[model samples]
Target: MTIKDTAEEWEVRATETPFKGNKTSVRTDDVVMPGGSVARRDYQVHPGSVAVLALDDEDRVVVIRQYRHPVRHKLWEIPAGLLDIPGENPLHAAQRELYEEAHVKAEDWRVLTDVFTTPGGCDEAVRIFLARNLSEAEGQRFEVEDEEADMELARVSVDELVRGALAGDLHNNCLVVGVLSLVAARHGDGLDALRPAEAPWPARPFEV
Candidate 1:
């Protein structure tokens, strides 16, 4: 079947419950079908987010191993966060997360891609960035005292990271997407040369 744009489209009829903790909203919308049928639909809109892919002098990607409360499991992920405040750009939020979560600062930064985490129901967007020329900095982690999480920094070959992601070893969507994009942009079609055969990690995750 061929889909055609109709002059009568969706319109927001009403909105209720402007705010909820997370993953919940109440909205009412109106739609006019091509056959002159009218219908109403409710929606839930979520917020946007940012993610960072940091690279150090040794060409090692900086990653954080943190226990995600929602997932109820410890997983390796890149530094990322939601835009808690209004009108905050994703790149600035990413820079803040990099320093807060990893305690590292980048001298050079570039936006790799912008993606929608889930488009069917929520209006969430994730902006990925590549950070280079990293240096030691102070961590500004989440202020929640009850949050159970400890961070460890690991340096792995780009190839190993990609393999781990495909194997479900690295499950964080933001990290996998951002790092892989950077790897592709850096190496083009010849990515095998950058993959590592084994894990090479530092004694701990701290300022270098």
Candidate 2:
């Protein structure tokens, strides 16, 4: 049997939206179980997201520190943002995020990995990209507000970030996943063997 995620939706007897937010909403579904029993599952419905792991010639990763109210901590993370529009091209979104968050642009791009953040609680799929050949973006930096207003930026080596992640110091989902995936790719067949940046993402389909 192939060890890959397959899409197969269980029978939904009923579904409802109890709460609706600006970008996401709470969804409750009465699903049929294996024993012919019905169960209610509530989860957040998100529009999906894209993240960029910008690697410089020095082998450092661009990172940002920002406040997350829900977690009540200033977590260090890579550049990431929501898809904004349904079926929006993830590569474009990732590039925009890298520029806006880190004022960086990349010449080489590849699909690092894709993941489901908090699958049990939210349907938020994130497509992480490996962005290399980095250079500062041209033009004024994007203005940030709220938690982002106090954001901090840094570039740390891949090894240090991996250390922090394993030491239980770094907790950002994107950063952890991105860095680890980067390490894995380097150790595996190699970065060149990784999927193309525009590779198909069944989790969040987008136009070329």
Candidate 3:
């Protein structure tokens, strides 16, 4: 369908500054639906984000463990973050986050997939990247105030990563999807053979 025919037209009806100080902007709108029905909705359009599934020479994938306050738990995840400034593309953001969060830099980069984290409620989208040719670097650069990310970089077998996803051990959906897409793109039907048997994720935190 064409954009003009399928797109929903929206007009802002009113706005209210519910809170200030944080970098959040809440917007309320009233729109006329395609069937000539009127409806009101609220939206929070955040800046887009990027994530990386970095691989090393030994065929090990980089994974990180960090405390997530929202979930009130520490979880293993691929390196990722939101774009703080406007006009930053996913590749550049991915490269920056690799160094900022994991203290590593990649010499080569490839786009794995683009995902909408929650299209129904938010405008947040994340670009997943495959990073390789890694080298050690310095410390992380966190953006949020009172933010403390004690990151542990681990090298996990791709097979174990997939298995973790299947067993519901890995909680991040984007990370699972990104790694699987990269595996499929590289090995076609042979991806299953690249997985290590009885692989386990790193339980300790380490720098690059």
Q: Can you write out model 3's per-residue Cα lDDT over 109-158, one digit (the tens) per residue?
A: 76666677766666676777778789987565444333333667789988
Model 1, range 101-173, lDDT digits (tens) per residue? 7778887776666677755556566777777789888545445333424566677767788889888788788
Q: Clashing residue pairs in candidate 3, if any?
A: none
Clash number for every model? Answer: 1, 0, 0
Put down candidate 2 lDDT per residue, 1-208, tens digits, no spaces: 7798888899999999999999999999999999999999999999999999999999999999999999899999999999998899999999999999999999999999999999999999999999999998999999999988999999999999999999999999999999999999999999999999999999998899
**What is the lDDT of every predicted structure here?**
0.67, 0.95, 0.70
In TM-score terms, which candidate is top?
Answer: 2
Model number with the top lDDT: 2
Which 10-residue span in candidate 3 carries the lowest summed lDDT?
A: 197-206
Q: Please give the distance, in angstroms, between residue 187's alpha carbon in candidate 3 and its true position after superposition.
A: 4.4
* Predictions: Cα RMSD each: 9.9, 0.8, 9.4
Candidate 1's error at 67, in angstroms? 2.2
Q: Kindly indicate the candidate among 2 and 3 with the higher TM-score.
A: 2
